[model samples]
Target chain A: MRTFFNTQMEVLNSELIKMGSLCEEMIELSIKALQEHQDFYKEILKLETQLDRQERNIQDLCMQILLQQQPVAGDLRKVYSALKIISDMERIGDMALDIAKIIKESPLEYQERLENMASATVEMVHLSIDCFIKQDLSIAHSVTQKDDVVDKLFYQIKQDVIAGLSKNSQESEVFINYLMIAKYFEKIADHSTNIAEWVEYSITGNYVGEEE
Target chain B: MRTFFNTQMEVLNSELIKMGSLCEEMIELSIKALQEHQDFYKEILKLETQLDRQERNIQDLCMQILLQQQPVAGDLRKVYSALKIISDMERIGDMALDIAKIIKESPLEYQERLENMASATVEMVHLSIDCFIKQDLSIAHSVTQKDDVVDKLFYQIKQDVIAGLSKNSQESEVFINYLMIAKYFEKIADHSTNIAEWVEYSITGNYVGEEE
Candidate 1:
């Protein structure tokens, strides 16, 4: 019985890791598409759907594992953390798709200022994923720190866009859309930081204090 | 043993209701403060903290019930639903506080426009809490439909404010803050709708498709 339980737990762990990898790949592909100005990237949508499916699958799998195994102590924490992490990952995928849509709909050269926003967001995504993979709570704490940077960048971009709108009020509609884009990027970073916070909590059983 | 088990489950159920009531009060008071401009009433941070503590406590209670009672089928669903509901409730409280702060800090008001937004949001809150108390899936689903109404109100208010801003751009900062207050109200409505969706899922085991 012990051997059976250990093997099943191993399988669950690997399945969770695979799901996390799927999330990471979706984020990476979305960022690449945005940076390269490739609006025609059909694969981003496919990856987004795949990520969503994986999230649902992982959640269902965790419930089954919990019911069947009734994992104790640290094992229970593992399943619980996976449940929360997958949720955050799914949201991150949604954020990626939102940015992809922005890229697809807008003129390729129009969102140049957003280039900085995407870069900051991608950096946050990478830091979050790294923290999860390594279970490094310090690195996870860092993800929260960088969220402020993303937010600051978002505000800076917003002001610049708003200023442009006020100068050429005719383009206010277009510029407002740009501000929304920046807002979306900032929200994505926020979700990624949320994931990293879960990593910290799962490993340390502590809420990562707000840095700012 | 059976009597002891049932009593324990009853206590858990009572705790769940208690936590839900606290969440409901937080939403109601937040609306009261925001709409009535009673900034002092926004000092419900203690309610948030208490809700958080209750959430964790009820979670623990649920876990203990699951182990001791070994709830089956419907009882199992009830326990798990309590767990999920606490999460949604905690977030709802957080958002309420966020909106409260907006109400507390902002000196500028949009006169009747702010009232319109508050009325829309509070109506949604009323409907959501009603659904929650009744466990009426239909009412819960209907809350999603009204988000668009709140959203339309948001845009109308925003347009009016922006036109007002055009008259005196210095007012743009205040109007944007006002816009955010409306947005936060909209978000609280959205979160309430989300709770409703969870209720539907608890009853039916599937999302009935949110009405936007």
Candidate 2:
């Protein structure tokens, strides 16, 4: 029984790592899609569907682990964290997919700051997953600091958009699209912050979702 | 043991119903805030915080129940459903709060259709919770239908905002704010649809998030 439980636990960990990697790939693909403001729907949609399947798979694994045998406190926390973190990660995928679909027909005037913001948000996703993989609180805490950079960049971009809005329908439309894309990136970072909190909770038995 | 488990389940059911009511109240208050275009921050903030606390309380109760006793298939589903539903509900609260904060300093041109959309979205929230309270799959199914109404309104408003953008910064800003607020209402409806799906899963043991 002990060996069987340990093996299942390892499977759970491995599956989450895979899902986390999928999230990173989706972010990268989304940024690439954003750079050209082109249609990457076929590839991006495949990743989004994979994300949903991955979430369901991990969900089933968690329920199986919980139902077959009673896990101790540590094992229980791990399962619970996987169950919670996948939703955040899945939302990250969905939002990135949303970013991909933005202004596909008519490419907007993309800002360099917007690309930097996406890069910053992507780093936060990477670090949060690494924290889960390595079980490191310091890495988990670092994701929070990185969120500050993303937020600052978002505000700057938002100010520029608001200030630059004009009576020209085409020009303002481009500005609005950029604003929406920036908000999506900001939200992606927020979801990463959520994963970091869940990682901290799984390791320490405490949760404080400090990202508002 | 069975009797104790049943009692705990009753407690769980009652707490969820309460949380569901808080969700309803938050939606209603947010709509009222939107119609008057006033800052309902204090009351809305209180409800949002209560939502977070309610989520934490229910989460603790779920972990307690899961840890203390071994539930069978049905009771286990009940716990899992509650765990999933609360996150969707809390997000509904958060999104409603986001709607409340839109264009507070500048009162935009209000659309009566937007109010109707908010009303329809609020009804969806009420009925989704009712499905959980009564374990009614029909009510759960109804939520999917209501989502169509919300979506239609959102698209109409989106088109109007897009077409109405002009060279005046103030004029287009209002339209953009209206667009953002409409999107928030659409998202609140989406979260309700998520709850409906969870309720369906809890009852029929099948999950289909068909609203998307």
Candidate 3:
């Protein structure tokens, strides 16, 4: 039974990694579509559906483990965190699709700062999942701290959009859409931060920055 | 043991309702802040913290029920749904605070269309939680359908902002801020839709709009 539980956990961890990679691909493809001015909406929508299935499968598996084995302490935390992390992963997929939709509608040339923001958010998603898979506390903490960079980039993008509006209000709609895209990226980073915080909770049983 | 489980479930249900009501209050306060151009940041922040603590307590209680009783079938689903719903509720609280933060920074006058959007979104939140508490499938479905109204209102607000910008390039920052607030309300409605979907899932074991 112990070995079986461990193997099930391994499967859970691997599935989570696969889902995380799907998120990374979706984010990359969305940005690529923007930078190259191509349509990736179909591909992103496909990935989003795949993520939903993955989330349901992982959720069922986690519930089965909890019901069958009734894991306690660290094991219970691991299962609980898996359940929480997948929701965030699924939201990240939705965020990518949102960006794809925006790009499809506007097809704006990617600004340098927006590209930087994209890369930063992608890195945060990657590292947060890595922290969970490896149970690396340091990496999880780093992901939390990295959210500040995304936040700063969002503000910079907002300022740029405002400046563009000030110069030529004709493109106000485009600027607002860009601002929305940046905000979505920031939100994706926030979800990554939530995953990282859950990772920390799984390891230390303490949610970072959570007040008593 | 059965009696004890029943009692614990009762406590869990009541706590969830309390948390849901807190979410409703937060949304109302956020809209009030915008309408009155008053500072509700402190109150919203306090509510956010309270929501967080409520989430922790409810989560712990759910975990206790699952571990102590090992509920299966419908009982298991109920506990799991509680866990998921609280996360969504916490996010609704965060969204309210996000709106409050924006209002604090910018203090844009409330437009009539925005007021309509706010009322629509608050109703969605209210109905979603009501569906969850009462386990009413029809009410849950209504909340899901009502999201379209909020979406339409958001687009209308967007168009108004754009028209305002075309007429006068100045105050573009304020218009953009209004746009962001409108977008936030749309997002809050989206979260409410999610809660409603989960409520349906808890009742029927079917996730509406979930493919395959």
Q: Mind giving the per-residue lDDT tens digits that candidate 2 earns over B1-212?
A: 56887888888999999999998998888777777777786788898888899888888888888888767577777888898888888888887777776745556656788888888999999999999999999999999899999999988986667667654566765776788888888888988998999899888878787222
> lDDT per residue, candidate 1, A4-61, as tens digits?
7787767766776776677667667766765676873467678777776776666567
Interface RMSD of 3: 4.5
DockQ of each: 0.24, 0.44, 0.51
TM-scores of the candidates are 0.81, 0.95, 0.96
Model 2 stretches astray by more than 4 angstroms: A210-212, B210-212
- iRMSD, per candidate, in listed order: 4.9, 3.3, 4.5
Ranking by DockQ: 3, 2, 1
lDDT of 3 by residue, A15-120 (tens): 9899999988998898899789898999999999899989998988998998888888888888988888888888889989989998888878789999999999
Chain B TM-score by candidate, in order shown: 0.82, 0.94, 0.96
Deviating ranges (above 4 Å) for candidate 3? A209-212, B209-212
TM-score of chain B of 3: 0.96
Which candidate tops DockQ?
A: 3
Residues B96-142 of candidate 3 have per-residue lDDT tens digits of 99899998998999988999999999999999999988999999999
Which rank order by TM-score, best down to worst? 3, 2, 1
How far out, in Å, is residue A7 in model 1? 4.2
Residue A176 displacement in candidate 3 (angstroms): 1.0
